[model samples]
Target chain A: MFPGKYQAVHAAALTVVLLALAASGVQAFIFSDPGSLYTAAIPDSWIYQAYHSTDQLAVFYGEGDWDLLYFEGLGKVADQSVRELAERSLALYGEPGGLSGFQLETPLLPVEVGGLQGLACAYTYQDERGNLLWEYRIFLLLPDGEGFSIALGSNGPWVKNNPPVLEEVLKKWQWTD
Target chain B: MAVDRLRKLSAWVIVLLFFSVIAAPVQASAASSGKAGAARFERALGGGAVPEILKQYGGEYVLPLGQRLWVEEVFRRLVGAAERQDVEYTLTVLNSAELNAFALPGGYVFITRGLVNAIGRDEAKLAAVLGHEIAHIEEKHGMNAVLRQMGLTVLLEVGMLAVDFASADLLRLAGTTLLELISRGWGREAEFEADLVGQTLAVRAGFDGSGAVSLLDGVLNLDSEDLPMKVFRTHPDTQERRERLEANLASFWPPPAAVDDPQVLERLNGGRILAQAGRNDPRGRYIVSLQENGAGLHIFDLQLGESALWLEGASVRDFAWSPQGQYLAVTLDEVSGDAVWICDRWGHVKRQIDLGRRRASQLSWSPEGKQLALLISDSGSQGILVTYAEADALVPMAADLGVEYSTWLEDGLFIFTGDAWYCISPPPVVPVTVQNPVPQVLQRQRILSPTVIKEGSTIRLTRPSLTMP
Candidate 1:
């Protein structure tokens, strides 16, 4: 075989291998729940945990390691304001059965949830078994009195430094109902 | 020359990507079919081994001979009514306080003691729970996970839950522990089907189908707070299960006079304990610990050895069981600031009292189990406050904040503060706080803790052994 032909063949094979690796690793995705409870553009490489997911909860893990993202749909929080719900949620998260060592990273702010007016708060906690640093974002939807949260817990520092993948997720998230 | 090489590379990449999509081993969200359905499921994990492993997770409760006969008889009747008669079903009672019932392949149906206690004497409710498990086994839902990724990381947690669909899923869950899987749920569609079939079997077995409703109601009682919580996190989510079952069974809806006397079969099976608040309610079988590091309070069933309730926010500085072992007083470490929670037998927090800037310790219940006496240490001094666990404020024996002493008067129990000794029962001689008498009357029947006596302005008491501070 000619050296030029050999170089082209080698280049082609390498391209295919890299493409396969990318497909198995950081793949593009969309999640549509069977019950039509939710539809969202899942963050790249995030594996949706269907068994753990429920009508009220959608759990996703990213980074091929453990960058956890939880989309929890808390229905009809009565007459409480988003801020109040955020406080109660923090309290619940700080309760005995909830996350460990949940400390507020910052005061709650008004933000957008799937493009809705919502209350946003950031807190840090160790996992239930007193595991690694877990930072969580609570988004209480002002409309419908419903709320969802996006929490990112990690055992590695890479996830903390990377721009949150949830930015794309929330940008594409939509309520099917 | 470079452009020509890039074109060749691009052509190969596009062709490879096209084939990958077609050949990808990813499972579709839909229920699989054809050969996938017919494939041999769990050659080793399928049969009796699954139940034994489950029994290891949820330890077995060997019932008394007569009571065992009654439950077995109930199981036999339900088995008689079920459609799949080939599978010989066996019922194993689990010594767990969590309201749970699960079926393993090979007809092994397990029910927890919590369900038994919650159902009390209602054989029908027991039948409803047992029937659900039986339906799961008969439908083959219990054994239907085919091998996937045959060479992947197999997490046989306790040599349980390995190399199958659940374990296959486990490969992706880098963060999900077995506790999270169990705490969240198994699945929904299969669970809902089990409910329908289970209720049908129960009705066919001469038990009221509404027993499913009452049985779920008991779960609601334990899980009402929507605590995304540890308790009553059923396979299909409890509230939805009840609604779905109710909608499906709407024709005969609530069977007339279905308000069953749950106490009837209860007494026949040798007297189950009904929780009368403020006394030693025998409903508590799970023991709790602020496991060594003191950050999380894990409630472990004495018999099951499984941690059912995991309370994990701050260090549990102190904890004490009520005199009757019906309630627990837990003082959380001040990482969340000072507070004490009055929790039920199952360790679900019934009430949380914010202790301002001060901290509390030595959580012990007062005699007769009506009030909790905890030593509250403020910035200045530490003093004992006798608080009625039901109310937020301490029910002052008189007007002062501290319980100087406590005694059993002829009429009732009296606690002395700096001002006066107030009688707390046979109607309080000087009731300073609003008293709810029902539980107090029940507690008056017996001395649950060792003893307590009130002196002029001082009291000495001995608490139950497991008091933590």
Candidate 2:
């Protein structure tokens, strides 16, 4: 159980949200999928199954929420080119109702995780109505030459409220190669 | 004169009637605002009620449940995959914007809609959160808190009545919502421990172990500006956790690379849809009395509109349920006193357990329903866990963690929230002798005050002394 020490902090946080509202009325927001930042082409089926299997996944019921799974199959692609993949994915999936326009950050961070090369990026989108929807994207470049992208976007009125369940579908995506 | 009087009366009557009609609608509108103005509304206004405010703000929503059910089902499957016990677990939707999740003893896990909504978009991050909370339950965090708060005798006593002492402590706790407690935003060591366990679980389940880092990193970013301050203020400092995670990654997944499982997200989304249908109806019958938000035990029949099967008094803190559903055991103490009142399901005083001049800090019941445990301390430092029987016979089982609170999972396994746990076997079979523990060290450690314990047939308490320190 949380102790009495945290009341002030939460109370303050509440004030911040309220203040944000006063400055700008509550607005809807969403994200455009940042294109695939895959290092190389990987089979989508393996990516899909990793998302499908319930055994190893956890659907967090908190912020940083997502459906997570591991996959194998993608060979490494050039780091910069993977940004193109992310752009493509965003162009295909990021239609802008929950978000305005989506933009991506670079993806060269080396992450220690399952044997796949990890690509991390951030997305900024405006909802169709034009609110700020911020999404942080994580793409795992698998060992077998395939890659899967994990995008977290919010569609909530304040910012965006995209539920992490979207990862399940993205996980299933495979490469033609 | 008669005609003039009649005309005047007529005029007055017409004016009164006209005003009444005008006032009616205005009054109704004000009343609606008042209802929505309450604290609950504040909660709703945050993120819980986002659907209604999306257009007002600038957010998009996926119609028909928002994958809430998909997330639930996906988590459930993972729970099953992890072999979580088959017990009736009810989830309360906490209305907060912070990243938090916690499980109360007795299969009760409360996750905020904010958390649910957030998890729907990212599979790995979602996994990290679920795995962490599940680990808390798996590791018996609730039970441990009970062990650290109360002792065994009062635990068994309140068990029959569904009482909990931790409520006061939980209320006394610093945060406004339960999420803070689960996230251990206060830098709780137990929280860090849960995170560790969660990371291992994620890896064992074939997830990228670093998911925790991703999740934490994302959570840290929510504040936007206070990144450093927030990280330092919360449990396990985000950066340190990431570094530690990098070191531990090798032990679990070899090569430690990022892997993708798109299917996991698909199932989660599907599960979220189904779960949305099953979400609890806040308008149901078991309404809290208008006088109190939630003071004592709040129980509703499977069907709403039914009478509350049981309720406890305000000062009568924390309780545990009987495995057989026959009774509840509760602990009662003055806001700041040395006496602890043990009560039963019907709200009758069973007997008072005295902590020898010092007030009892907490009480707990073992899963077996036969034995009880008590944690008595004064001024925070001195504490001990006394294993006893509901029959008024007390016995000393183990010491350490200062026995602040205790809860039983089942049989010999019980978690003392202070430091470790005590696995009392065969019902303690003999009576316990009470002893006075030193009070200094007890005050420094964080302990669970109001606690609840629920255990099934298969749960085992193998360790005698499991210390957190």
Candidate 2 structure quality by residue, lDDT tens digits, A80-160: 444454454444334422223655544435433334455555556543345454555555544443444443334332222
What lDDT is obtained when candidate 1 is compared to the true structure? Answer: 0.55
lDDT of 1 by residue, B63-177 (tens): 5333454577678878988886456677778777766677755576777776666666667677888898888777766443211112122222233222333223322331123
Error of 1 at B403 (Å): 66
RMSD of candidate 1 to the true fold? 33.8
For residue A130, give model 1's deviation from the true position in Å: 44
Off by over 4 Å in 1: A1-177, B1-44, B48-58, B145-185, B223-231, B250-469
Residue pairs in candidate 1 whose N, alpha carbon or C atoms collide under 3 angstroms = A96-B311, A96-B312, B121-B266, B280-B324, B406-B454
Angstrom error at residue B198, model 2: 1.6
Judged by TM-score, which candidate is best? 1
Which 10-residue span in candidate 2 chain B carries the lowest summed lDDT? B436-445
Ten residues in sequence with the least summed lDDT for candidate 2 chain A: A58-67
